[model samples]
Target: MSTVADNTTVTEAPVADLTNVLARGPRPKRPSAWSASVTFGWRAVLKIKHVPEQLFDVTAFPIIMVLLFTYLFGGALAGSPREYIQFLLPGIMVTSVVMITMYTGVGVNTDIEKGVFDRFRTLPVWRPAALVGAIFGDMLRYAIASLVILGIGLALGFRPAGGVLGVAAGIALLILFSFAFSWIWTMFGLLLRSEKSVMGVSMLVIFPLTFLSNVYVQPSTMPDVLEAFVQANPVTRLVTAVRTLMDGGWNTGEVLWVVVASAVLVAVFGTLTMRLYNRR
Candidate 1:
């Protein structure tokens, strides 16, 4: 206690209590949603840097597929390896990129298991920041995969009649569609218990959808029932759309159907993922 100039008594508050309050208030400002997303996206890129093996599927797998399919089945399927490659490149591009979306689920599940996900949940950033960042980061993988396929195809004498602009358009469309398709895997990541399980289930579902379509052979050659399934397959439609674009021709019907299908997938799976994320 001390005597004031006016003669009134004064008391000082405890210094330790005030220190704690001031320390709590001085925390760094929470980032905006976009900033948070970009920050997390950078983190994801760094993760890939640390684990370069994450790119094996996008790089090596495409090379193997292009070489294997063109050499092994080209004569039987098409007139020659060259002709088969011309048809096969676009289909393989779409199918391989789509197949890699399952890795998003596996990655997310691994984060959850590692407790990184729970820490993310406590952050003051947008709730979907991690998911969006992961998806955006995957665009790099998609581009790398596309480049690998195109580069190998070109080396193997597979030329695109679509010209550079058309090839560029096809690649852009595939990446856009892949981004939308990833939400379904993200939902699965949130719902599933393990990354291995997610990978297993994703492979189980994806293989049939891809193989049953016109990825490897002409649908016209299939049995009537198989042809119908091939015709209705969304992957087949996407491949057709890509083929048309790569051929420098417009196939509005196929492109529109693929866009509509992608929109529906994004809407459905995005909502489901968010719901599950919140619950978790």
Candidate 2:
């Protein structure tokens, strides 16, 4: 059909033409949960590609922490920089890697601010994929941080008594713990209204946990009250497991505690983050 008005013309397709257009091909299939997650994870990685400076924390920060602490506490605590690095390497690794986990939340809040997630939520793909995939992309940063710290430690003559197996196991455990730990920040990303707020709270919590724990020195040397809190700190538990592994020992108690706690962090915070996500 055709019509003309105001020096303009409009034509409508017939019913058979409309039907042929819609029936041109079968509809595309929806993506699977895992597939969708990986796609979002790749999106996160692409963000890094476009903005390479985002890697500063995973690279430069860990290097600075290692050099600063190794020199600052080396002579007084362990008689030499090399000596202190042995005790500090694994702890520093844990600190650097764990501290970076909060960026996952920051990234989430960034996406939300850009309305990127609004588009994601409207897709027919899995709901949790975006979050999980973002964390997955962050796992690469965690690994890079660990490797940078490890390389610095090695260059400074720090050697794990547990050798290859121990170092590998330690890094693996740290990655797993960090993966679970990222969920807390993800929840905050959803609950908080701003990226600065998420970063502010994350720093407040992380500073106390990292500085007050057994990351820098032995908890046994601290006052009893401080030592008790140090012993109970989750980062302390992680450092213990990591240090023990690097020292050529298997402390099942410490390792199991970390594994179980990691599970709990994910189970609890993962649920909460998803709820916030769905409701958002």
Candidate 3:
């Protein structure tokens, strides 16, 4: 063995040049905005596939909320759970969907903390695709939560006088509002350093918006000053529009308000969110 080793010639193979072997052709075309966003949206959906526990919020939590409110406040509010479910369902759907929008911010913060966003920024794709696509994915979750509440309400004897068309419109408007509303949280995600802080601020803003408004009670029952605030609440307007739609009619004024407010939220918060995202 020693004799063979000593006799063997020390011939080293030459290192291959990866520069020539690698992608020597033209670079692939940059993805279009729609394509990039859809790709990112698929990524978000795939995240849910890997971690199905995320469905808990859209499914179980909404179910719990539907049950808790229908029974807990039904009798006191409307003489019976069945009767109150009619009034309570749409508003609660709004509450649950909007409340869950904060998780968008939490998710953004988590991704940023994990350096996922850092990698995203280095990619050659549409700038806002990640944020927009994340919102698109969240739109699905919002719809799921809305449907969960709606299904639970239906089972609880809640009937939509507006029927299928009305219910569809109601759900459509709610999802649209939730879509625009998510931008606010994305802004907070970029501004905040941690998920807890993002969630805290989101809750602080959401609770007062949802609770102080007409979600649980009519503004008529609130004092004048409180009622004024409730009337001014954008969530109140959205709920009113959704409720009216589900009740077989349209609330022109509230519907207009919701539309205008949605536009404003997307314009303002959307701008701020993009700015922060770029800087971050």
Candidate 4:
């Protein structure tokens, strides 16, 4: 009986150890670079799909504003509605892209508050770059919004003298500017505690930036103080560059300044957003 008991104990020891190892199972492999980016991009796109209202604001508001402004003030400002529509189209495009910054910040805040980013931290991707990729992926929506606005402008008789190439260049410039502005708002979204606060704070800044520029009329037409503000504003430089580009003229200085300003903004705000992401 003693011999039988010893043999049983000896055999069970190895079996028990095998069972323990099996319980733990194999470790999960880290995600690859392509997989991580695709995951992040798809998630971002899905979020946009779920919240159609976010896109509606950009699409619907610009159309309404263009109609209202072109009809109401067009005759008074440009001696005819068609001319006013042309003058206002570029400004509207600039404002439309700038307004997208609000959504950038709000979206970032929503993801953070919901702990979506926390989940991303566990993935094998470069976390900072993932956030940027996600934000940039949304630029597709901005581009679409811009196109819709341009189409409306065309319908309203706002012809671009720059032809197809100039129109394409104008659209490209606005999208690039929007991407640069996204970095700033993304930083704000990462730093702010809530979505509502992000929206409020971003709008508070964007409204003045949009209106104080030569968006509606020539800077010379504004009051002295407003004219000075318009002259000093970077948006004015951008507007001038865009106007020249679309009007089929060459203003190298304005274009150069706008490019430089955009570069500086992207560098500064992009750095800040990365730092904030790292800390988070």
Output the number of the lDDT-best candidate.
Answer: 2
RMSD (Å) per prediction: 4.7, 2.7, 3.7, 4.5
Give one digit per residue, the lDDT tens place, for model 4 in 149-254. 8999999898899987887787787777777888878888998899988888988888988889988988887889988988998777788888778888768998
Instruction: Give one digit per residue, the lDDT tens place, for model 2 in 1-280.
Output: 2335622422344655677778567788999999999999999899899999999999999999999999999999999998899999999999999999999999999999999999998999999999999999999999999999999899999988899999999999999999999999999998899999999999999999999999898898999999999988999999999999999999999999999999999999999999989988
Cα lDDT listed for each candidate: 0.89, 0.94, 0.91, 0.82
lDDT of 1 by residue, 144-188 (tens): 999999999998888888899989988988888898889988988
True lDDT of residue 213, candidate 4: 93
Better of 1 and 2 by lDDT: 2
TM-score versus the correct structure, for each prediction: 0.90, 0.93, 0.92, 0.86
Model 3 superposed RMSD (Cα):
3.7
Off by over 4 Å in 4: 1-39
What's the C-alpha lDDT at position 172 in model 2?
97
The lowest-lDDT stretch of 10 consecutive residues in candidate 1 is: 5-14
lDDT of 2: 0.94
**Candidate 3 lDDT trough over 10 residues, lowest sum:** 9-18
Candidate 3, TM-score vs. the true structure? 0.92
User: Which residue pairs come into collision in candidate 3?
Assistant: none
